[model samples]
Target: MSTKRDIIEQLEKNYLFAVIRGKSFQDAFEIAKASYEGGIKNIEVTFTTPNADKTIEKLSEYFGDTDMVIGAGTVIDDITARIAILAGANFIVSPNFSPSVSEICNRYTIPYLPGCGTVTEIANAMATGVEIAKIFPGGILGAGFIKDVHGPIPNIELMPSGGVNLENMDTWVNNGAWAVGIGSALTKDITSDDYTSVTTIAQKFSDKLKEIRSNN
Candidate 1:
């Protein structure tokens, strides 16, 4: 497995974080693996997925030995964070900031990306050594929000998720997103039994991200 620092760097460099939120562990695992095959090295399996810990464990065991990084998402508290960490999660992500969660992750030297909707939230999360803040519900907040936040905190790293699709993903990166969390956009119409579309979309997303990076 890569070091925590390496995992953090990968997320920034790749600019693509595949969010795996499925109904079951089997389903999420396959989706995550398909995304990985599609070239997304950073994956986040939400805790809301049934047997999330097992999914994390399975994926971690599979990808931990490679350059791929897998993490736990939707972690709301310190306990959940710790559970995921021990389950071999390379990092932790939450919908909102939690000091306890941050503290625990800090103790493990694990990277934490907490959801932040405003400049104040971003600043606070950054103060806790969080490398990147997520502009959650990015669709509602819009790519412009990232630009607006970056105006003053130009040095802060931000990854916007939610409502991010091929149509508008470029907008976010163009506006100053360090990375992005793709959910339904990447998995739309994809099911465990039908993953060919998942791979197809993943490749499109990966190519789009590369194209955007070249322009930047």
Candidate 2:
């Protein structure tokens, strides 16, 4: 099994997490597969989807030997966190911080990335051993928030989720985002059964990140 640090490094190297929400298990699986094919090494399947646990299980088994990382998102409590881990989630994420969820993730040695909107929340999360704090509603916070937060807390790793897209991805990286999470931008107008657009969009994102990293 990969260590927590190993997974963290992988996340940083990839610099993008495909946030997937599907109406069904097959929908989730296919989207994830398409994302992987498009060079997305990290994927976060939100619990909002039906049979999310089963989807995580299948993803873990399918990508068992690859460097791809599968995570559970929208995880709000310890019970859901534990369930996701048991179902083979490599990490856990939530829209807001939860102490119980943090404790369970720490106990299991899985990386926990909880949404934090303020310096106090980020500091509180880091105090509980969180390595990366997700800046949800990134569009609202904007890339400037990362820079602003780094001024007071220089070492905090911030990954922006929600509203992150190829157009503004460079700005986020330029402002020192640890990583980024993309959702509907990757699927957009594509129908449930046709994920070709997903692959196309994911590739663009992958390429954009690479270009940004190279320039930096």
State the C-alpha lDDT per candidate.
0.86, 0.92
TM-score of 2: 0.97
Q: Write one digit per residue (lDDT tens) for candidate 2, span 1-216.
A: 568898898888877899999988789999999998998879999999999999999999999999889999999999999999999998999999999999999999999999999889999999999989999778899999999999989888999998788888999989999989999898886774888988998899889988988998
Candidate 2 Cα lDDT to native: 0.92
Query: 1-216, model 1: which lDDT tens digit per residue?
Result: 446677777767666889998889999998998898888878899999999999999988887667778899999999999999999888899999888888999999899989988888888888888878888878789999978887888888788879888888888878888888899877777754988788888999999888877987
Give the clash count for each candidate: 0, 0
Clashing pairs in 2: none
Candidate 1 lDDT (Cα, whole model)?
0.86
